[model samples]
Target: MVLQQRREPYPHWEYTDPSGAEVLRVVPERGGLVTGWSSLGRDWLYFDAERFADPDLSVRGGIPVLFPICGGLPDGRLPLPQGVFTLAQHGFARDRAWELSALEGGDGVRLTLAHDPHTLAAFPFLFRLSLEYRLAPGQLGITAQVANAGEDPMPFSFGLHPYWAVDDLSAVRLEGLPAEGFDHHTMAPATLAAQLEALGEGVDLLAHPAGPVRLRGVAGGAAVTLEPDAPLDLVVLWTDPPRPMVCLEPWTAPRGALISGDRRLLVDPGGCCSLSCRYRVDRGWG
Candidate 1:
C-alpha cells in the first residue's frame, strides 16, 4: 500500500496512510488547519460539524496552531518595547490562511504562514511559522518552526490545541504530570491532585520537564500519548461540556506570557526555534 494525497470537493486536502487505516485532512485556506484524523477505523480527533460549515465562525475543533502568544495578554493588547498593539486571544495564526509548501508523498504535509502587513500590525515582528503534519505507523507528529526574520530579536509563545474525542470526561484521567498547575482564569497556582475526576470545569497543567503525558479512556477504548519536545513548557487539559472531547495542549509558555514575560522564547535575529510533539494512539487494556 502506498500513501495517497487528494483534493476533495469540500476544498481541502486529504492524506492517507498506505494501508488506509489512518487518515488526515487539512484545509490550507483556513489556517492550514487539520480538521480530521482517524486511526484503525476510529476517529481520534473531534470536529465541530456546525463550525466547519460556517465560514464566518472560527473552527472550534481540530488542531489549531497558536503562535506569537499561547493564551492571552493582560488585556486585548500587547505591550512591546517597540509599541503597544491590539492582539486577540490565542493569537491570529489559526484564523489566517497558510500557504501549502509541500505535501510529501502523502506521509507528511508542510504548510507555512509568513508575516504580512496585517500580521505585522498586530505582532510587530517579521517571522515565518511552519507547521508540518506527519503520520507514521501508529503516531502523528506535529512540528512547529518559528524563524525570526526581523532585524531585532523576537519574543513569542506557541501551542497546539488538539480536541481529542473521548467516551466521557469523567472517564478520562491524565497521567505523567505534577500535582500542581496554574489556573489562568483565577490567575493563581492550583492543584490537580483530585480534580482529574471532576474536571468538568477544566484545568491547565503547567509544563513538566520530566516526561510525556498520556490520556486514557478515550473513545473506542484507546489511549493517546503526548510526547513533547524541547521548549514546550506547559500542558493544558480542558474540556468543553456536552462535546465529548478533551484537549491535551502543549504550549511553549504559560498563559499571560505576553504580559508576564515568563518562559517565553526569544529568537535572535536570523535564528530559529522549533517545538514539536508526537501523539501515539493504541488500543487500551479495558
Candidate 2:
C-alpha cells in the first residue's frame, strides 16, 4: 500500500488499513528510524533520532535493529572517525530513509537502504541493506540482509531490538538460557569476559535472562524464540523497573569500541549478513 506521512506530536509517516491497524512508520532525515510493524505488534514501535539523547540508554524487549554495534560508547562519544573504523555506532543505515521497494503477495514488504559517498566517509563502502518482515498464518518472520555493492569488501555488524510486553515483569519467564551469562560493562571488559566464560550458557542477570521464555499477564501470555546462525552469539533482555515492556536483542557481535577487538565483521563483495527470529502469542497462560 502507498503509505502517507503523518506529522503531529512526533514527525512520522504511517501506513495502515481502513480499520486503523498500523503497518509502518518511517522517520527520515532525523535518524532513519522505523517504528511500526511489518507483521507482528501491528501497533507501535520506537526509534530514536538523537543518538546522544540517551548515549547511555536503550529500551527493553522490542526489536531495535543495531547495524554496526550495540550499547553505549566510552566517554559518551560515538565510536566513528576517531576510532579504528569510521562507521558510527550502529552504523549509518539507521540514519537514512529506506525506500519501500515492494509490498506484495505473500512475499511481504521489502525496505531498501543504500549508502553513498557521504556514508562512505564513515563506512567507506558501497552497500545496500534490505529488511524483510514477512507475515504468514500465525507467525512474523524478520530477515535483515546486506549486500556489498562497492568495488571493495565491506566490514560491519547487526542486531535486532524488539520490545515485547508481558502481563507483568514478575510473571514473565525466559527459557533455554542459563541462570548466569556474560556482563559487558564498559569499565570491566576483562571481568565481563571472565564472567561470560564462567557462566558459559547460564543466564546472567546482567544480560537479563528470564526463564521459561514466556510472557505472562492478567490478559494472557506470549512466546519468543531466537534462532540465529553462527554469526550471532549473544541475546539481551532489557526492561524498565515498573513498565510492562521488555526488549529482546539478538546480536551478531558484542557492541563496544573498535579497539576492544570484538566489534568487527567484514563483508566481501556480494557478501551478506542476516539474523532471523520468530514471535508468537497465546492466551490463558497467566
User: Of the candidates shown, which would achieve the greatest lDDT relative to the real structure?
Assistant: 1
Residue-level lDDT of model 2, residues 1-286, one tens digit each, is: 4456776535666555333432655454433445544334333233333532453554232244576556545553444433534545565565555676435653345677788767666666678877776545334566778788766756666776665554555555655555555555333323333442333233222343333244333123545454444455466655544555556566666656343657467778887766565544444344
Candidate 2 vs. true structure, TM-score: 0.68
Q: Highest TM-score: which candidate?
A: 1
lDDT of each: 0.81, 0.53
**Which residues of candidate 2, in runs, are more than 4 Å off?**
1-32, 38-62, 72-88, 185-220, 257-263
Model 2, residue 175: distance off in Å is: 1.3
The worst-scoring run of ten residues by lDDT in candidate 2 lies at 196-205
* TM-score of model 1 (CA atoms): 0.92
TM-score of each: 0.92, 0.68
Question: Per-residue lDDT for 97-214 in model 1, tens only?
Answer: 9987445666777889999989999998999999888887679988888999899889999999999988878788778878877666566777776557546666555545468888
